[model samples]
Target: MLRMNINNLIKIFFLLVILSIEIGQSLIPLDRYSTSSILIDKKLFFFGGETVHNLKPSTTLDQILYLDVSKPFNTVNPPFEELPNTIPFGSSYAIAFPSSQKNVIYLFGGITVNVNTDLDDFKSILHSYNLETNQWTIPTTSGIAPGRRREISGVINNNTGKFYAFGGLSDQFTGTPNNTIALNDMNIFDINTLAWSKGSTINAPLPRADYTATLLSNGIIVFIGGRETNAFRDVDINQLALYDTKVDKWSLMTARGVTMENRFLHSAVLTPDERIIIFGGRKVPNDDPVLNQLAVLNTKMTPYEWSIPQVPAIDNMPLTTSAHSATLVGNYMFINFGQITPITNPQIQLPFFYILDIRNFTWIIQFEPEKSTIDTTSVNKSPSNSTSNSPDLPVEKSDNGKQIGIILGTVGLSIGIGIVVGFLGYKYYKKQKYKHAIPTAGSPTI
Candidate 1:
């Protein structure tokens, strides 16, 4: 009987262990947008962002979440690990880029939200995180820093060891009647010396933010469409602002291609062949038609040309994604969390990160393309006719919610079984003790 009881307890313990593993595997990070992420040595580290929960106010997240891209992982069950925070700091619209030196990532300006007051406080401080040490530090530096700002477009020239920060939504005029100012001034940061310096504002484009700044191989930075100083206007899509870093001069070039609508809050990634692929973004008005097509800009040509690629329609493809981080890893571009719909509707959580194989422009859910079918085709400049209506509700029900329900149910069942087994074991031990007990000099015996 004793051996049988021990066996039963052991079996139950193993069952609980297996259930716990399942719960852990199903767990994923919260839904977030405007998050900054950096890809270092095949590991993608996600920084501060605003998290959205059903029926609750959005919350700024301080936690650091990361995914190992070197290994093959399922999209539904992404193996994301959380790095412990040494100091708590959270913000949205921040930019994170890896240093030329290995194992270091630098986070620049962003806006911190005061949930209690529902106000935004812009930040201009610099924070550095060491992947090797797993430590975060605010490094002191000499020279003047840029004004408090968010949604700033920045890019690092690894050869020069400098980070170039351009136009952003500044809070310099916060107390003044203007209250909002778009900055076109350039700020330079020396990664090696930990110092800041202002760059030239000569012939800069109209003050803008929520744009993309891509660094070319020939020491030139290309600025794309963005929200201009006038909050309601977007920078013209036909003009490409080129900043020649070698001489610190700015010039505007006209791009030849199909007439494209103005866009902001979009993501752009440079291809090996000098093509800038522009992904999802929104127009000035949030309710306007969504920019669901991918725009490719060929920069190597004497005159820059734009083309809207025809991508095969795939189910569950994000029709609208803005304020998202897109990082290119080899042939695949990994798009992180972002708002899929207008801000007026409830934010829906995405179960998986979207992956695009730039080689053939195929949308994939898994990291490894071999596990899924790949329909390859040559580049076609044909326009996309696919149009998506602004979804009144979430596009798809989140699998995370169902997973949470399963975990909760399993926990409840586990606790109930534990309690019953514990009670039976106790009763059995008490009966055995009584049956084995010897009567001494008791006055009354039952």
Candidate 2:
């Protein structure tokens, strides 16, 4: 009978093992996706980005490659493929403004040249690509555009069909010392009417390049840190300002994370929660600018507040870097491809990739990877007539992130169970060992 009982337990254990393996087959996680690209509206897009080795120049790609993010995970699906090389300004920080002027993507000022030692090699021209046609077209409008610049932001008032941009570094004349014109001017492009209009300036407006300004859903434009125009030396500004589109007025808003660190060429992503997530930018020394600290702000509250829940997370040198591209797909934030200028070693921004899922926003260092949820109802955007390709989201950690997580979890759980089972067994064993040894009234002791 005892042998039969043991045989029954063994059969049950094997059956459960087979069932768990079957269940795991249906669980496909996001980390398994190997593409280092980001997704918007279920469409994944990526181009070659900044690499480390600063002294060596990098290439600027002109094609936009995409994959459908909403598809079910399958081993047979093709990954990201180029969507005809038509879009202009495939460089970093090209001012991707969605919900702007009937859903258009604008490519603006960024470095077309990486001469290493020279700061004069920035581009000033602005280009826009129509998503419907997959074509790049320059705006035919009027204004003294501070072209060949960087650190500019574009926001669209879709209701008015007006797309606006302000603040960048560009010298209008045959001059030196790039993108520092001290012009705190506003330029707006009317996509519906196809025209340009310069905005009136705020009183005592500070000149800033490498600063960040984002248009909120409430139609308020908020600008963050940049190099100030206080020419007396040893003075860099980290002030916050705002512009209201409805009222056409600009003002300052007090915010945290405005430390002396200059946050130029960094990215500010408005999360699904309406909080802005900032990523790598250079921290300038002694008022000499550039920084890599990322600061997120919860500006939804009156008297806006900044949040840097993940600071000094990247445990590498040049801790805060600039000219990197970062975006949020789902709950995770993707930061990759940027330039880094070390104090002595000529600027080299290595091609580093990071995946910051929303859960890790509280504990970023131990960023655990999660599996992708297979929602059959989700609409994926493959080419209309072609089978959707599955370009995977990069697994920023080791390929074993998922496997390691499972191992750790199983070990942790098994250890816990073992401790409980051992304690119970010890109680049972001791009960049997000393059951007859108890000092009871009826027991005889020798």
Candidate 3:
């Protein structure tokens, strides 16, 4: 009787375990989509740029926006709160990094409205906003200021508490109707020390501006193809490369896997799996064509490789435009902004967030965002990751926290239930055999 009770308990436990796993997977939205440079804290950050409306001959912008990146679709409020007007004029060349000791957001450089002129000109100063204080502090740099540049690629080196900026035009902005390629420089800024330094190319380096740079987990900074200055076209060079900060050397191993085409103002998301998820850059073919395609570059390989990532549909693809931004949550990617202009004037609207859930290999187009801003939509919630995907088999990260929890719970419950079920079965079989062997009442005991 005791054994039978144990067996029943075990069966119940197993069923419970399976149920738990299923529940976790079912409830959690495990995927994210993006068309922006991705950064994080407890929250996600992105600054919007001038779309068609503001892309006048010499337009400067004033909008800085961000999103939570972790909202569920059914959520009615949609949780995107526009932050208080912190910066006066909108600018795109802004880079955000956490301060040395405090949790304050240090937003430095790019372009902004000059208090006196209101012209969208190069901003040399830095602004530090305390998320806790809701105040802004402009800190001065001791060394030479990084010359003004736009669409420069930058990433905060977590190891050194410094920001390394690469590939941007010089402070020289020619007011030409078109054709400006003079601004090209790579530099590094020490966030802690507040110093500026320039980078010299080791080998044949691409002096390309408006390029994409993502910091890999291994501390290596991988750079992908970008646009050359006011040339209005992506560079002829489409190869990828990585700069090892420790060694201060560049590597040629960035040209492997699927070769990416030349694109500018494209967005790359470092998936939890360590693969760079890239999307929506205007492609400059021999014959220029606007692209609305998606791709992924695997930076884990020694020769960093790239290939087009698969999204669900062709009908509802992201509209072809640059100056847009994207963020990732779980396996899904959230893309927004980069105003659509038949001509460069500017009509602003929140493009409904497009989410790519990776678990079921599905893409969900959610249109019912309830907020004017996107502070709550584009979040990256991937777990600990490693690059083990071979050329053939691609490894995916935990679809989302909820999915992972469900899987673990299911496994636990299965074992728990299995123990009880096995025990009961054994006990019942033992009782049957014992009865068969009993001889005292006319059967011989074996």
**Stretches of model 1 off by over 4 angstroms after superposition:** 1-23, 54-58, 113-124, 173-178, 346-352, 369-446
Question: Can you write out model 1's per-residue Cα lDDT over 167-197, one digit (the tens) per residue?
Answer: 7886665554657778888889998888888
- Each candidate structure's count of clashing pairs: 0, 25, 48
Off by over 4 Å in 3: 1-41, 51-59, 74-78, 115-117, 120-122, 171-184, 229-233, 285-292, 314-316, 339-352, 358-361, 366-446
lDDT, model 3, position 142: 77
Instruction: Tell me each candidate's TM-score.
Output: 0.75, 0.58, 0.63
Q: Assess the local accuracy of residue 187 in candidate 2 as a C-alpha lDDT between 0 and 100.
A: 77
- Angstrom error at residue 333, model 1: 0.8
- Give the alpha carbon lDDT tens digit for every residue of 79-139 in model 3: 3433456355555555666777565777665656543455755355467777666676667
Total backbone clashes of candidate 3, pairs 3 or more residues apart or in separate chains: 48
Q: What is the lDDT of candidate 3?
A: 0.55
TM-score: which is higher, 1 or 3?
Answer: 1
Predicted model with the maximum lDDT = 1
lDDT of each: 0.73, 0.52, 0.55
